[model samples]
Target: MNMQRSMLAVLLASTIAMPAISAEQGGINAEQGITTAIPMPVANNAEADAQLSAEELAKQQAAEQAQKQLEAIIGASGLEGLGEQARNLAQQVLNETQAPLGFQYDVVDRLTPLWAPVALQNTLASALASLDDQQRELLQSTLNSRRLQNARSKELSAIADQDNRNYQDYISRLRQQPPAPARVALIKQLDEAMQFSALLSVTRSSVYPQLQAVLRNWQPPQDWQAGLQRDVTEFLLYVHRTTPNDELQRLAQAYREPVLQQWLAGVKKSLSRQAG
Candidate 1:
């Protein structure tokens, strides 16, 4: 009985091994009289290799494009000279000087009332010019106090700050995420909001009267009561009209970066959301 059981186990093992052995050694189909091996699927590593190659090539191309753009920007900025010290100094000076001009331009653009009446323009100019330094300070302080007291200034400030914060947050978030089609749509929405906030920030600066004073080169006239509104108005207008767009363009190029773009987009989106 033990011998019979051993024989049965052997038979079972042999039955399982038969198909595997035949697959390796091939066989003849007796009825068809044909011999064939068991077919196995071939792995097409070539396709994977090609895909990897394509991705590598794309990355290389993108790197080259970014390098070229950086070179072009540097060349245009007049920083092509090889003198390291000179380049550093030049960059430093530009950074210091250009920032204020850009900010001023932005503020002037957003807040300055459109179309100052010829008569009122003159009155404003003359009033600014006729004040003593002490009187000017007092008047400025009073105006500032009044603006702070007004709901408009506080509301605008709150809105601008919130938009700026939103813009910054979105940009930070995007930097970590993988690129996708949805990002493009989101970016566009953000860009518009950024522009709106920029404009709003300028408007909220409340620099219109101060700008007029500076343009007027205000001085206490021989006749204290007299106003030189027209002259002051003309200067303010001239400053507004003649403020070059070139500086803003250059600054835009200088500050261009993916993060900045994202931030800009975010600001824009925030403003749009508020508006809607």
Candidate 2:
């Protein structure tokens, strides 16, 4: 199946029977956002009959907190109310600006209150569900700080108000200047810390089984999963391309904080485990 179709299937599996939630998506955005959850994969133990293991309790609590946080972020974003308007606004922004190539502008337009699928939301939950309270707190605080940093970057960069030609010209010049190797390395670090790739991977893996269960004779392209991965990667690169370099740097720096690095390592590991 094509990636968009695959995305649609994930959303279908998530919300088909569930009540339509208010357009609360995940993440915080200073024109950006983040989200997480996980609960199911805790290994069973010898103490199963006695009481909840500490790990089990922590994971359960983390999942509950993740669900609550997800709700809060979604409500704050008011993404549901802006459904069609987001598309219009994104297009309008691109029309006014010297739009970046690919899907970057669309990403900037929609990053806030990200209108992601329910399955994707669940994938995030599953990712964070393994953390303890301390880790979860770190996630909220770190993401909130990143949100502020993004807002600050937008304010300081003033790219929003710059003349279109000059803005595009600046990007052209910046493109000519090869980025510092460290900066490139840092950007790659942010990419891993962000968890978008892992979420996409795990969500796709989770969705395929649902598709098989839902549809009879669900023959698909042999390389369908790879196609889905390629599409998602390219699309996210497009999003990354539109992001201001300075802002991207800030995101990288924010996530490089030790606490987040430690927490996200576990989350990424969990999601990857599911994907495999």
Candidate 3:
């Protein structure tokens, strides 16, 4: 039984640790791709409680959150009460899924600074290589414009500042208000929501749509645009495939629950506008 559990952990870890390629600006790094190993058994020594950097602590918390979400989905049929066997199964799955991720993190940490720049350069070059010479030159010229770059930077900063202010206000309100079931549920759903938001951003910023608008005059091959869309969709599907189908269905249902809908109303409207 112990050996079986160990094998399961290795399989899950390896499956989730492989990074799926994404075309958009933000792609998953090692940290976001998976998570830490099965936590070492807590020790009584002070060394066991060594301080972690804020970023490391945040990643640890995120891993914990993912564990809770996965457990919730797996135990959905009997979530109100878990028997010992169910609890054990959940732990076994969690350990297996995250163990390989720990090794991946170490490798990525060592190599990222050395290879990330080259990888990014290659990705950009590959994208540009698909365009006709005139089209590629046109984009290169626009990107080189200092005024346009500055304008975009200022615009993005303003948007980020407003978002920060809004978030702070939300947090302040939560502190002042009494606890409610809906509020608690919303808090629990945050990590999943953020993942969804990331997916939305990737789809929204996809090169296929940009090319559709920019290359309207160029009349790029019909098959070329379709291929780009297919590639982007496949990448997104790969990320989603990490979760079991039943778990994904449960997550979708939970998002539609009243508590999440209330919080997500504004986001839904914004997404709809983008779609339109």
| Candidate number of the best lDDT | 2
lDDT of each: 0.32, 0.45, 0.35
Q: Write the per-residue lDDT of candidate 3 for residues 98-177, one digit (tens) a residue.
A: 53554434433332321233332223233333344455334434433453344334333433443366534643554466
Point out the worst 10-residue segment of candidate 2 by lDDT: 1-10
Clashes of each: 11, 13, 1
Ranking by TM-score: 2, 3, 1
In model 1, which runs have C-alpha deviations exceeding 4 angstroms?
Answer: 1-43, 82-276
* Segments in model 2 whose C-alpha atoms lie over 4 Å from true places: 1-134, 146-189, 214-216, 242-246, 258-276
Could you give candidate 1's per-residue lDDT for residues 1-276 as a string of tens digits?
001112112212211110110111222343433587554344554566577677767766755653443333222221111112122322233344443454443423332232112221222223233344454444334333432224224333433443366534543554455335443433323323223224333222222233433334423234421222222222222222222344323323423433334433443343334223
Q: Best by TM-score, which number?
A: 2
* TM-scores vs. true structure, each candidate: 0.19, 0.40, 0.23
State the displacement of the C-alpha of residue 203, model 2, in Å, after optimal TM-score superposition.
Answer: 1.0
Answer with 2 or 3, whichever has the higher TM-score: 2
lDDT of 2 by residue, 171-263 (tens): 455457745666555455555655444544544454344333433355335885566554433333333555767777777677576755654
Against the true structure, candidate 2 reaches a TM-score of 0.40
